[model samples]
Target: MFQLSLATVSHGAVASIPLILVAPFALLLLLIATMPLTPPRVKHLWEHYYPHIAIGLGLVVAAYYLWRVEGGGTVIGHTAHEYFSFISLIGALYVVAGGIHIKVKGESTPVVNVAFLAVGAVLANFIGTTGASMVMIRPWIRLNKIRISAFHIVFFIFVVSNVGGALTPIGDPPLFLGYLRGVPFFWLLDHVIGQWIVTLVALLVAFYVFDRRSFARMPVRLRHESEAPDTWRFDGMMNVLFLGVIIAAVFLPDYWFLREIVMLGAAVASYRLTPKDVHLENHFSFGPIKEVAFLFIGIFATMMPALNYLEQHGHEFGFERAPAYYFASGGLSAVLDNAPTYVNFLKLAEVSASTGGGGESTPAAEHAAVHQLLADRPELVIAVSLGAVFFGAMTYIGNGPNFMVKSIAESAGVRVPSFFGYIGRYSLPILLPILAVCGWIFLH
Candidate 1:
C-alpha cells in the first residue's frame, strides 16, 4: 500500500526537539480555553495580562530555539516571518474592512439570515474568510440586532469565517499554503466542491433551525420590527480601493516583506482617509485585532514544537485510509494553526505515497512527491484540505477570523459563547456532526 519509504524524508533540526517543549503550547491553549469560565476577578486578571502571558510563553520557546537546538535559529526565523505575514494580512484586512460600514435597514427573518450567510460564504472564497468576516460581521449583527444571541455569532464563524473558504487558495490560509506547495489553484474546486456544498448546506440548514427558534422567541412587535423591508446604505466606499490593494498585495514577492509592507501601507491609508462617521457607525477599534495579534504570537511560537513533533512522527499513526487522515488532520487543525497543520499532513501524505520506489531527499523531490500524491491518491489530498479548513471553525482559536469575529460581536453588545461554551454548545452538538457526515460521505 505504501509507495515511498519513510526513511527518504528528512527531519532536519526539528527532529532534536524534545516532547517536553510542547508544554508551553499546551498550557497556553488551556488558559485560553478555560480562563473565561473562571470567576469574574480571575477572568479580569486574564484579560488584563493576556498579552504578557502570551508573549512570555512565546519568548520562552524562542529562547530555547536560540540557545539550545542546532540550526534552531533558522526555524525560529522562518516562524517569525510566517507570523509577521499572518498578522500583517489579518491586521490589514481588519483595518481596511473596518473602514467600510454597511448599514442594513430591514427584516432579519430566518430566510434573510440564511441568504446573508450564504452570500458571506460565497464572498469568503474571493476575499478570504478573514476579509469576509471583517467586512460582513457588523452588518450581520445589525441585521439581527433585534434577536441576536450566542448562536448567531457561533454560526457566523461556522459559515463565514471558516468553512465558507474551502473553494480557493484565497479563501483560507491553509489552502494558500497548498497552492504555494504546488497544488493547482483550482484543485479544491475540482475535487471537493461537492463536499463543500454539502457541508455548507448542512450548516446553513442547522443555522436556519436555530434562527427560526430565535425569531419565534422574539415578541411579535419585535419580530415585526426585525422583519420590515430591507434597505442597505454603503459608507466609506473609497476603502474598497484599499481592500483591493491589500488583496493584490497578497501576490507580491515575499522578498524583504514586500507583501506585508504593501498591506500595511494600504491599511494605514484606509484608516487615515476613512470618514469618522463610518468608523463610528462600525464601532471600529483596535482592541479585537490587538487581542488576536498578541495571542497569536504565543500560539505561533509555542505551536512550533507541536508542529515539529507531528512532522517528525506523523506517519507512525498508520493512517492508510482517507478517513484517518481526515479526522487526524481535522482534529489537530481544530487547535493548532491549521496552515502548518495542513502542510505537515501534506508532507505525510507525500511520504506515504513514496513507498513504491520514487523517493528522494531534496526540495525538488519533495515538490514532486506532492504532485505524485495528487496524481495517485487525490482523495487523501482532498481529505487533508477539507479537514484543515472545515475543522478550523470548531473553536475560537481554530482560525484567525473566529476570534476576531467573536471579539467584534462582543464589542457590539452581542452575546457570544465563551471558548469552551462555543465548542460544547455549537461545535460538538451542531458543527461536528455535519463535518463528520460530510467526511464520511466524501472521503470514506
Candidate 2:
C-alpha cells in the first residue's frame, strides 16, 4: 500500500497539481448550478448534452492524473469504491421504497397536512428522503388538491424531504457518505438526535402557524363527496419487509462488500415481488436514480485529485472552529450536490485533524488518524453531518429529491416556484433565519 503523506509529497507536490486538473470539475459544477436557471433554450442545450461534456472533461483529467502523478491510480480506486457504495444504496432505496405505496382518503386540512408531513418526516428515516418524498408527495398533493399552495411543497422539502433525514444513514446521501467514511451506522442516534428534534419541532411549529393562516382564507371543501379513511392502507407491503432487511445489511457483519450485495438483492426482490400496479401508481422510474448516478460519475472521478490535494495540504485552508466546518459544508451544499460537498468537508476536517498532537503537549504523544476523529473530536463530524443534510433544503438543487418533488408537483398541475424564486422567496426568508438560530444554539 502506498501511504499518502505531506512530508513525502512536499509543498512542491501541491504546486505540481496543475490548476487545469480542477477546471473541468469547476466548470461541470458551475454548469449544474447555473444551466437550469438560465434561459430555457440554452438550458435545454446543456441538459441534453451535459453527459458528453462531463465525460470528455473527466477523461481529460483522468488521463493527465494517471500520467503525471504517483499513487494516482489509488485515488481512482478509492473514488470508484465510494461511488459504487453511495449509488448502490441510493438506487436500492429508490427501487424498494417505490414499491411501498401510501393510499389515503382525506382532505388536506391544516391538521391533516401536519399529520401527513409528520408521517413523511418519520418515514424519511426508514426509506431515504428521495424515497419518502417520492412515495408520499403524490398522495399528499392529491389530498390537498382542492387548496394546495406553493408553501405546501416548500415546507415538504424543508421537513420531510431534507431535515428529517438527519437520524439515519439510509435517510440521506450525505449521512450515507458519512457512513462510508467509517462513521458508525447508528452514530447519529447518539450525536444528532437532540439537534434533529429541536430543528424538526421548530419547523413543524412554523409550518402549523403558516398553514393555519393559509387555511383560514381558504374554504374547507373535500374534492370528493366522501369522508376521510379511518386508517391509511399500504399496497405492496412486502417491500417494507425488504427494507428492514436492507437496513440490517449495513451493520450486520461489517463486511463492506456484502452490504452492497444485500442492498442490491433487496431492490431486486422488491421489484420482482411487488405488484406492478403499485410501481405504476408511485410513478417509479429509473430516470431520477439514473441521472444521479451519471452526474456523480463525473463528480467522483474529477474530485479525486482535488481530494488528494486537500489530503496533502488540507490544513492550509483553515477551519479551526467547529462552526466553520458546519457553515462552509452547508453553504456549499446549498448550491452544489450535498454528497460530494459532505465528503469534501469531511476529508478536509480529517486531514486537518490528523496533524494535531496530543493535549499533553509531549513530542511522543499519540497522534490521531482521520478515521478516529469521530470519537476524539466528535463535534466536528456532528456539525458537518448536520449541515450537509439539513441545509440541503436551501435550494431545489441541494438534494436529488428536491427537484424530483418539484417536478412531480408541477407535472401534477401544481405551480412550483422557479429555481431562483425558490431560493429568494422561501429558502432565504424561511430556512436561513431558522438555520441562523440553529447555528447559534447548536453549531457554535
Candidate 3:
C-alpha cells in the first residue's frame, strides 16, 4: 500500500492548500464560469449539473496528483474502481427506486410493518437512502396528486430523503463505512433506532402540520387531465426484473458477477423479449444519476488531500473542544461528499484516543495506539454514521437524490427554491431544526 508522508501532506494548513480545503468553492466558481457556454434551453441544466461536475473534476485532479506526485501508492484503476462502484450502485438504485424501499400510506403517511414499509425497509438496507428516495418520491407525489402545496414536497424531501434511511448498512454511506469497518450489520438496530425514532416523529409532526394547511388550500374544483394513457400501467413486468438485477449488483456484487450475471442476462433478455411500449415508455435516462455520479467523482478525488490531513492532525485543530465536530464534518460533507467525510472523522477519532474496548476513548495521543483505539471504539462509528447520513439533508447538494428531487420537481413545473433560498426556506426551517434535535439526541 502507498502512503503520503504525514509531514508532507500536512505541511500546508487546511486553508493554504486550496485543493484540500477550498476546492468545493473553487469548483463552484468553475461551474459559474461555464454557465454562459451552455445553451439557454439548458440553462436549467447548468443549475442542476454544475456543482456535481465541479466535484467530479476536483476528485479526478486530486487523485491524479496523489498518484503521480505523492507516490500515494494507490493505482488509478483502484481508485476509479472504488469511485465508479459507488456511482454504479447509485445508478442501479436510481433506476429501480422502489427496490430501495420507502413506505407511504395514502400518499402522505408511512405505516410501520406494511408491505410498502417492508419493501422500503428492505431496499433502504440494500441500495441506500437516496436510492430509496428517488424510487419512492415520484410515486408518493403522484399518489397524493391532489395535494398542491410546495411545503408538502419540501416535507417529503426532509423525511424520506434525509431522516428515514439512517438505520441499515445500505441505507446510508456512513453506515456502510461502519459495516466495512467491522461493525456488526445489526449494530445500528441497538445504537441508532432511538435517533431514527426521533427523526421519524419529527417527520410525522411536520407532515400533520403541513398536510392540514395543504388540504385546506386545495382547489375545490380540480381539473381532470385529458384522456392520456396512465404511465403507471405497463405492458412489461420485465423492467421490474431488470430493476431486480440492478439490486443484486448492489448488495451482493461478487455474487452478482458470478452466478447473478445469469439472472442479469435473463433480465436484459426480458427487456428485448418485452413489448416496445413497455420498455420504451419509461426509458430511463442517464441524466439525473449521471449528473450526481460524475459531480461527486470530482468531490471525492479532490478532497482526498484534505481528508488525509484531517485524519492525521484534526484533533490538534480543536475538534475535541467543540460539540460541533459531528455537525461540522457532516455540514462540510453535505457539500464535500460524506464517504470521505466519515473516513476523515473516523481516522481522527482513531488518532485521538487510547485503545479500550467498548465505546470509550482516552485523552489525545501521538502514537499509533490511537489508531488501535479507533479500531476498537466502534460506538464512535455510530456518531460518524449518524452525522453523515442525517446532515446530508442540510442542502440540495448534500446528497445525489436531493438534486434529482429538485430536477424532477422543476421538470414537473413545481416551483423550487434557489440554492440559498432552499436552505433558508425549506431546509433550515423544516429540516435543520429536526437535525439539531437528532444531533442532540444522538451526540449529547
Ranking by TM-score: 2, 1, 3
Q: Residues 1-444, candidate 2: write the lDDT tens digits.
A: 233332212122322456557677778787777787788899889878877877777778778667766555545666677788888888999999899888876566677778878888888998989989998899888777767889889999999899999899889998887876677787888888888888888888888998888767664454332235535778988888888888888776535678889989999989999888998998888888877877878888887656655666678887777888988989998998888888778777876777642122111111234347776678888888888998999999888899889989999999888888888998998888888788778867
> Candidate 3 — worst ten consecutive residues by lDDT sum?
357-366
TM-score of each: 0.83, 0.90, 0.70
| Cα lDDT tens digits for candidate 1, 238-306 | 988987898788778778999889999999999999999988877778987898789878987987766
Q: If ranked by lDDT, best first, what sequence of candidates would result?
A: 1, 2, 3
Kindly give the number of clashing pairs for every candidate: 7, 0, 14
> Judged by TM-score relative to the true structure, which candidate is superior, 1 or 2?
2
Provide the overall lDDT of each model, using Cα atoms, as 2-decimal numbers: 0.81, 0.79, 0.55
* Model 3 alpha-carbon drift over 4 Å, by segment: 1-4, 7-77, 98-123, 173-184, 217-283, 321-323, 354-376
**On a 0 to 100 scale, what is the lDDT of residue 34 in model 1?**
67
State the lDDT of candidate 3 residue by residue for 245-362, as single tens digits.
6545445533324434443454445545656543333334556666666665665565455544554555565554223667776776566456667666766665555322112111
CA RMSD of all predictions: 4.6, 4.7, 7.4
Candidate 1 global TM-score: 0.83
Q: Which portions of model 2 miss their true places by more than 4 Å?
A: 1-15, 220-231, 252-256, 356-368
